[model samples]
Target: MTRMRADLLLLLAAFIWGTAFIAQKYANDSMGPLSFVGARFLLSWIALAPLALYERGKAGCASLGKSDLGLAALIGFCLFAGAGLQQIGLVTTTATNGGFLTALYVILVPLIVWAITGARPRRIVLLAGVVSIFGAWLLAENGHLQKWTSGDALILIADIAWAAAISLVPIFLARCDRPYFLAFAQYGVVAFLGLVGGLGLESFSGEGLAAALPAILYAGLFSGGIAYTLQIVAQKYTPAAEAALIMSLESVFAALSGALLLSERLTPLALLGCGLILAGAILVEAEPALRSARMVVRRRRR
Candidate 1:
């Protein structure tokens, strides 16, 4: 797929995830976070199994070495950490706060990539990252000076896990070009971990399961099965830096979704935060063309 198409996929995934905050928050009302996460990703793993098998069959390759398993396991741990904490955070935080706070990974991704590879991103990418984080802060705080809650703190930690998971994707994908399998593998790991954690820490009931069924289906099928699969495939084509910015739009989408669906109204300051987030996304989008034009001008002078 072209980078443009890959970016569009990320954009769509952002929308799905943005709306999914509502489902996630709703699920928290009926079940413990661990139980909800277990059910969600377990369902998603099942949904993706057929597609993963089809990809393996079409490629005529299903050879996963020990290294592949190792990488997938590491990614799974990061994903499990990230997804589990974010779900737990949604229980206490507003969907808007959860959405924007979760976007902290957009800033962390570059730093993690730099730390891992020692390759600096473009100046504009750095600038976009700074702008996006500021916007996130504003959106999350809504121009108020308030102490951070446990939920907010949880999502912040989840951002670190998200950045680690995202940075590792390129490394794994370079060695193994199977997006579906990787996604499936991580989902399986998360499902297993979540289920195990839930069983040990929280009690489950048939009524809770029934109460959260709609949310489980929405979070599992659309957010996990469809959106996350799109993320893995899109990241194969899109650069990680650009992909982070594109996906960061999920914050804006989450705010809007919260407003429309949950009647979470935003103040004027919050509106400015949303606008700034879009500005950052637009700047990230324009950076490549801007650089190419500058190089063209320099060539003409030469």
Candidate 2:
């Protein structure tokens, strides 16, 4: 039941994230990417502040030491890098493209865990990586190697950072059980960094902000605050690989959102690419159960 609830929460997060892609894309028309990210995350921080304070009070802050603070900052930096890159990438890429490319992080998460912890990844994960790589190439390369744009490169970098962030979450959850407090720290850090970058690198008017306000609110409240918090809570119960496999559905939801809301269309080849990525995720999710069933059959035969 706990795992089932976790899965449902993850699905909800995916839905919110998928829909937010359209909001993010629309915001870019009115503001610089960094500025949009800054404004959106600031709103998230604000929305989460009261809840975070309440959680900290209930849980007590004694367990949150200097090392905990440091880890929170690290996660926050990763969040900023990943999200900032994606926001910038969305400027030149379609929302559908951004959604699918970002999902590549699902394949990369196990590798990130292996690299960080020095534990070997499962063979199944490695195989999935190979398949996912081909799918990415098909999605990004427009029949020519030279056709890949700056946007694709940016989102690819974002995928790496996002993978690292996802792998690190369970580690942080182990140390600090206060998920709301951690959310506050990460969101606050991203907001601060984004604001500095926006002020230094981009200029925008109040009118532009007003125009982007609805999208900003949706992204901030639903995607950044609610969905992300739900993910942290869900991860406490679910294993990272399974969680990632389920969350990868965000790509499908994003594609659907792009079509329904933004009228974006994918080519037949691109749809095929989406299928491959989804197939890889499904394979990864089933690998453990398949291995168990195979072991049972072999033992019976012996």
TM-score of each: 0.93, 0.86
Best by TM-score: 1
lDDT of 1: 0.86
Task: Estimate, for each residue in 1-302, the C-alpha lDDT of model 2 and write its tens digit.
Answer: 37668878988998899788788888999988998888889999999999888887883564788998999899889999999999999888754466557877877888788888887777777677666555544554332233346897899999888887778888898988888888888999999999899989999899999999999999999999999888888888876755776677676677667768768776776667667666766776677668889999999999
* lDDT measured at residue 8 in model 2 versus the true structure, 0 to 100: 87
Q: Lowest summed lDDT over 10 consecutive residues: which window, candidate 1?
A: 140-149
Q: What's the lDDT for residue 229 in model 2?
A: 85
Tell how far residue 59 is off in model 1, in angstroms.
Answer: 3.9
In candidate 2, how many clashes are counted? 0
lDDT by residue for model 1 (1-302), tens: 88778889999999998898778888887889999999999999999999888889985565789999899899989999999998888777765566667878988888888898898887888898888878877887574534557898999999999989888888788888888999999999999999999889987899999999999999999999999999999988877877888889888898888789878888777788888887887887897778889999999999
Off by over 4 Å in 1: 60-62, 94-97, 293-302
Pull out the clashing pairs in model 2.
Answer: none
Question: lDDT (CA) for every model shown?
Answer: 0.86, 0.80
